[model samples]
Target: MLAEQTIAPDHPVFAGHFPAHPVVPGALLLDWACHSLGAGQSAASREARFPRSCGPGSRLVLRAEPGKEPPSSARRFAITTEDAGTEVAVVTGTLGPLSTAAGT
Candidate 1:
């Protein structure tokens, strides 16, 4: 995976997501990570432990298990195959079990 693009904040998706807070939603961040890997072929799965809310300007961070598979989402995430390989973007943030996903 491209390490640089993984954490770059210039991504357009975050622009209108939350103007006031400017926080990178937990699901979004995780989805991006999944995208970095091959979406359909990705063996990644995420389980965020939302001990505390990630407020605005929280500086989104990408944490991965190296070669672990990406997580599954209820909503449809964007998964595409490029020259480089398959990429999974825009994971399902519509789920209401964030706290449970995070094991909070």
Candidate 2:
């Protein structure tokens, strides 16, 4: 399954995150990812990774797949974007219960 988001170039977070050279906070990315993925329980286990920097106007593409090997209720996801013609992973982790319809 796939979900995507684009950070606004004028997003307010840029102001405090770094006035000179703004970079989207990893927390914000995680929040957006959880919401986009329809996470059912906020208390459930979750994690975020910063493999690369995300700036304003950057497009975040989320790809989700069923848990590997076991087919459990848990789902694996990754937020990535195009970098130098190659896809770069910005955040990767497992999500909690899904609140909405399942992903394909």
Candidate 3:
């Protein structure tokens, strides 16, 4: 699954999450990834890696693919800046469940 994410410039998360140098919280980023790639269903389990920081008002793309491991429930995914075309991922992990995600 794939998703286009545009973090709102005025998103409420900016209020307390580093008022001077705000960045999206890791937990919130995970939630966004889960909701977008999960196809609405929550994940049974997940493992993730955050290679970089993502700020508000950025255009991002979330991508997910089935993991190579057994059981077929495993998945691999990444979030990247839509325009950067860089070698880094703002966030990447074993997320994007098969159903609804949390905080929905």
Candidate 4:
């Protein structure tokens, strides 16, 4: 599945991150990636690396893919932003099992 988020210039974090030139925080981006996977899901192990800064007004897309290992519930995801058809920031990570429903 693919999830998308738009970076708003008025986001509260930007105020303290920088007043003159605001940029999206890497942690915030990771949070978005996790949220995209599932609200209740947790990552057992993961890795994330940012190649470029994502400024306000940027549109990000997160794509989820199944892991290569067999019989594993883990999933891998990639978060990216594009500019003039070129990929910008890329956040990658893995997700743990989804939380089961009550009584299940």
Report the candidate with higher TM-score, 1 versus 4. 4
**Deviation of model 2 at 89, angstroms:** 0.8
User: Ranking under lDDT, best-scoring first?
Assistant: 2, 3, 4, 1
lDDT to native, each model: 0.39, 0.73, 0.71, 0.70
Each candidate's clash count = 11, 0, 5, 0
**Highest-lDDT candidate:** 2
Model 1 collision count: 11
TM-score of 2: 0.77
lDDT of 3 at 57: 89
List of clashing residue pairs for candidate 4: none
Worst window of 10 by summed lDDT in candidate 1 = 74-83
Q: Of models 2 and 4, which has the larger lDDT?
A: 2
For model 4, how does the per-residue alpha-carbon lDDT over 33-65 read when each residue is reduced to its tens digit? Answer: 666666444543355566777788888888888
Error in Å for residue 84 of model 2: 2.1
Q: Where does candidate 1 stray beyond 4 Å?
A: 6-10, 39-46, 50-63, 66-104
Q: Mind giving the per-residue lDDT tens digits that candidate 2 earns over 24-101?
A: 898787777667766634423344567889899898898887655433656677889888888998878776554322
lDDT of candidate 2 vs native? 0.73
Model with the higher TM-score, candidate 3 or 4: 3
Q: All candidates' TM-scores?
A: 0.35, 0.77, 0.77, 0.76
